[model samples]
Target: MNQAPRQRMTAQARRQQLLTVAWQLVRQEGSAALTLGRVAEEAGVSKPVVYEHFTTRQGLLAALYKDFDSRQNALIDAAMAAAGDRLQDKAAVVASSYVNCVLTQGREIPDVLSSLDSTPELAAVKRQYQLDFIEKFRSWFAPFVAPSDIPLATMWGMLGAADAISNAVVAGDISQQEGMQELSALIITTIARCG
Candidate 1:
């Protein structure tokens, strides 16, 4: 009997496939399972393929982190755009959208954090993205608070609190609604206090 020929995927398609497989490993099996070999085996591709796309484990994590942040930032931008002129309304929408994203993404944030935390290059990348996010928050809150009043440290603190609350909701320690409500309140108050 003659076997059918397999369809070949393009390089970009294969890269995306590998990333998807890696993401699944991180989400379902934990970030510890996302070795190049495991990703290769699970993706049904050779180890060389993963190496070709991502020069190192750190490279793969960097790509994943960039993609994750890009997507999350896009969501936040959309939420803020649709939130109208009121800062409180914008804060509530932003908080809800952010926490809801964390709750719905199913371990993506933790997996990204775990996979990228140890690598200095990727860690720097993460930090830069965070700084950019904080800058955007600073711009939004500047009218309410002076540039000196809303320091980067304070913004980082608020973000840390939001993430902690979001993690609690994701882990079932708190309901999603409660988490959103609490986060919205926190964000609003934090903005108000920044003044």
Candidate 2:
């Protein structure tokens, strides 16, 4: 006879738990290893349960992106708010928070970004958030650098670089200090517009 099912999990809680486990597995290994099979195995749930939670790998990836996007955006928002009406300080705050969110949150963020990086479909999902980041940056970065001076392109480049470095550090290919230097260089280039 089948064993009694484990205590039923509320849908929201179950989804959160699945995401928690999915990201953990990705953090430990890589996003490529974050399949329904692995998540089910890690979460102590069946594959069907994972399927019910996420429906597809894309869905799962999208949710993961959403989860971290919320976090990153909040940090950016708080920095902007705390910087008050001062323009230069706002960018500094935002840059510090964005960099810290990537460098400090470490693997959890890198995993989510990696999983969604290659999925062009997710660009549409990410675009809205990108716009929000830009608008916030624009207001903050506009004073010191002309609206035109802010390295919008380089801003994105910095984000990609930070994500890659985080993954590298987790995999032991790069030192955390190395990651910080590289990321700091990107930030400096974006802010200073170095050629």
Candidate 3:
């Protein structure tokens, strides 16, 4: 009944491993349980290993958010490229991809997001990501609607709706089909109104 020795991993691989373990921890025990030491313990590495990657809890939280955002961006980019040139097709892709990304990550993201907003520094990081996402959305839909016609407020509103509807889907308040349909309609109508 001897335990096997741990295999060596490159620093980059180790960081990815730690992040994956950290996400699993958050999924099971919630974001409050996601301290660097906890991640180190769960990842079967020294605390310094986790510290080397994310020096602080805020740092770890920000990294988690960035990881999630990166995956979401990749999904949207791939789907958008495959989507038809029509506005409705683009809108549907956006809606389905956004919701599907959230659903794919399951319900843990909202907790991670709330944790990110707990501190001003982390909140700023989160806000910057949100702003970037809105800009990306604007650029994607700009072909259909004049950029100026959409207004910053409308973009923010659409983002809000996306977050709300996606969260509802994750929370089981609505079916995946219902959420995607409603979100797709919202995007199309919002762009139509702005145009």
Backbone clashes for every candidate come to 0, 0, 0
Using TM-score as the measure, name the better of candidate 1 and candidate 2: 1
Off by over 4 Å in 1: 1-7, 146-149
Q: For candidate 3, lDDT tens digit of each residue in 96-181?
A: 99999999999889999999889999999999999999999999999887755578999999999999999999999999999999
Q: Pairing residues by index, what is the TM-score of model 2?
A: 0.70
Position 57, candidate 2: lDDT: 86
Q: Worst lDDT window (10 residues) for model 1?
A: 140-149
TM-score, per-candidate, Cα-based: 0.89, 0.70, 0.95
lDDT of 1 at 76: 87
Best by lDDT: 3
Q: What lDDT is reached at residue 170 by model 1?
A: 84
Which digits, one per residue and each the tens of the lDDT, describe model 1 over residues 1-195? 999999999998998898889888888878777788889999988999999999888888887877777788898888887877776787788788888878777777777776567878878888888888888877776777764568777899878887888889988899988988888888778878777
Query: CA lDDT of 123 in candidate 1?
Result: 82
- Candidate 3: Cα lDDT at 142: 90
Clashes of 3: 0
State residue 190's C-alpha deviation in candidate 2, in Å: 6.6
Q: Which pairs in model 3 have colliding backbones? A: none
